[model samples]
Target: MAQHPTDANVYFVPARSKAPIFASVSMFVMMMGVASWLNDVSWGKVAFFTGMAMMIATLFYWFGEVIRESQGGHYNRQVDVSFRMGMVWFIFSEVMFFGAFFGALFYTRQYALPWLGGEGDGVMTNALLWDGYSAAWPSAGPGQVGGHFQTIPAWGLPLVNTLILLTSGVTLTIAHHALKAGQRRALLFWLGLTVVLGITFLFLQAEEYIHAYSELNLTLGSGIYGSTFFMLTGFHGAHVALGTIMLLVMWFRALKGHFTKDHHFGFEAAAWYWHFVDVVWLGLFLFVYVL
Candidate 1:
């Protein structure tokens, strides 16, 4: 039920919610579960799944309340502006997050690897310390630290996932335009298509990871190459999963006629997030896979 305004001038002040606290606790549990699972704890997987379920439920209920508030016309132009600014900062922070991982990749490839191979510092460090060291991209460091592992070629699954993400960006933009043009049916259709693409991309990534682990023997323990490779791609995959869930929620809101042509920040925010994920994947594809 939408809230009817009694006074036009009063700004709506929402009561404090426990969503953030619940989210924090669930995240802590999830991390603990992950650490325990890595150490082969008996109940680790159970805890992880339980935490995941709790987090999902929390988000669903919290966002549903927010939707109700939105439909109730609680937010004003000022609130909308604040939402936009908040989203901008959130995306900016994500940029820095991925930037750190990329910076590590660059430093390792450009400086650390060369120095260890005795290319810089004008010292034959490889010969003096470790003989017959091969300095190559996708290398497992000196003496093949974690043994030999084949690198996944950039022309196959990775290229396919890249195309998929790019196409998703297009679909999402189309959906945004449809919303702005006041075409609800087209908006829902295109938004749902974007979610499907996101899911497909995740499925393909899972397949790729399985191939890397089983056929290529490229585990996280595979030294510098594998560590960086998995780190970048793994985090990106998690982002994609999150963005997909956001889109799904927006899709449901769309179906409920929760957005109008002039004010659909919820849809816009999800689109922004999805596009960010797409852009990050392009970076990973180029630096991690191609270069």
Candidate 2:
């Protein structure tokens, strides 16, 4: 039996479960499989897919259990607080993760390029290494590592995607407010719009990548610029995909009448993640594309 939401004194301590151990096993297998694949092992691809399937299955079961517990009223205010704190830390870790990549970009552009191009203390280095090599924003190094390449135009697909993401953020916020106000119809409509915008953004990004690779000669191998551009935008796309999935799930739950005006942390968590993704895209737009 589960307690009501008001019973905050009794913290629900779930029984010891095998989910954690299984999750660990899945991750270990997946990592090992990827490592092997990178090393060109014969069975690596099959092993990697197998491990991925196992991990996906494990997550599905684990999340289902948690959803059941939540809907059963096993979660009190304390549990809700714990969940909130957990989400906060998770987002914080993501911020750090992206920060490291951005830091690398900054270091390459500001320090490494200037130093290698004979600026200040690098005069001797430049004279000895490449003689007349000049520091530039999108250089492929003095050696021309990947030959000639062009950069994607910031005013084109990138701008469109930015607008789409910003609009999605607005729609998601509207959906959140609708959920909080007990307006199920508006909640579903706006959330569905957000999901559509997310998918559209992903489609445009794929088109951009295709254009970069086929026509523009911009690829991961192009130069430092290409690498950083792909890394930042690619990872952000993955996050957008994940956020879209979360929003879709929340939309389904909303259809099932699973949330209330006062008790809708699940919806709120998804909204938080979506907003974080939107903010990250804004940073990417300014730093990677426009600048």
Candidate 3:
């Protein structure tokens, strides 16, 4: 039976859950596999894929329980408030995560590079280490640290991907509006379009990476530029893929009439995440690509 508002005078607490433990173990195995793979262990790939499969399975089962509880109306106003607060903190954590990476980029460009080039108070240090070194925005350092490589122009695939992500943000907003207006057909159409745009952006990003590695001779080892380039854009790409999956799940749920106009916090949360991803891409385009 669906839980009524007055069914319980106190907040409902769930029984002990093993999902956290399961997830922890899965992550441990995954990280171990990654370390092993980096060291050239033959079975490392197998372990890595195995761990990923386990992690996906665990999340599906664990979240399935939450979904069931939600649909059963076990959640009260207090529970809803808790959910909102949890999401807020979760997104805040993500902001800090990305902020660290961006900070690294800024530090390398503003301070580290100039110090190495003997600017300001770095004169003696540069003379002792890298005499005649010139500081340039996209330099590979004194000895071409990781070999010479060309950069992908800001106006190429990067620009196109920017447009794609911006368009996705618009489409998702339209979908949200449609949901609120009870236009189920329009909601599904626009939401599906947003998912398509996300996938397209990923496809273009992969193409850009391919060109960088093959024709441009740019790999992860191509100095600090390559490292930061891959770190920022790569993480953002992963976020896009994740957001697409979330949108797909929401699309399926919408098809099944899971959300009503006033009770669609689930959809709202997913949309918020998608917009966050879009905003991060804009930062990447401006800082990593254009600048």
Pick the lDDT winner. Answer: 1
**What RMSD does model 1 have?**
2.4
Superior candidate under lDDT, 1 versus 2 = 1
Clashing pairs in 1: none
Q: Order the candidate numbers by lDDT, best to worst.
A: 1, 2, 3
Q: Please, what are the lDDT tens digits per residue for candidate 3 over residues 109-217?
A: 9998999899888898799989988889897766787898999999989999999999999999999999999999999999999999999999999999999999998
**Runs with alpha carbons beyond 4 Å of true place in candidate 1:** 1-11, 122-124
lDDT per residue as tens, model 2, 1-291: 434455778788776678898889988888888999999998887888888898888988888888888888889889999999999999999999899999989999999899889888888999999888878878777787777888888899999999999999999989988988889999999999999999999999999999999987888887788889899999999999999888898889899999999999988999899899999999998988878
TM-scores of the candidates in the order shown? 0.93, 0.94, 0.96
Q: Top model by TM-score, which number?
A: 3
Task: Tell me the alpha-carbon RMSD of every candidate.
Answer: 2.4, 1.9, 1.9
TM-score of 3: 0.96
Error of 3 at 220 (Å): 0.7
Query: So what's the TM-score on candidate 1?
Result: 0.93
Candidate 3: where are CA atoms >4 Å away? Answer: 1-9
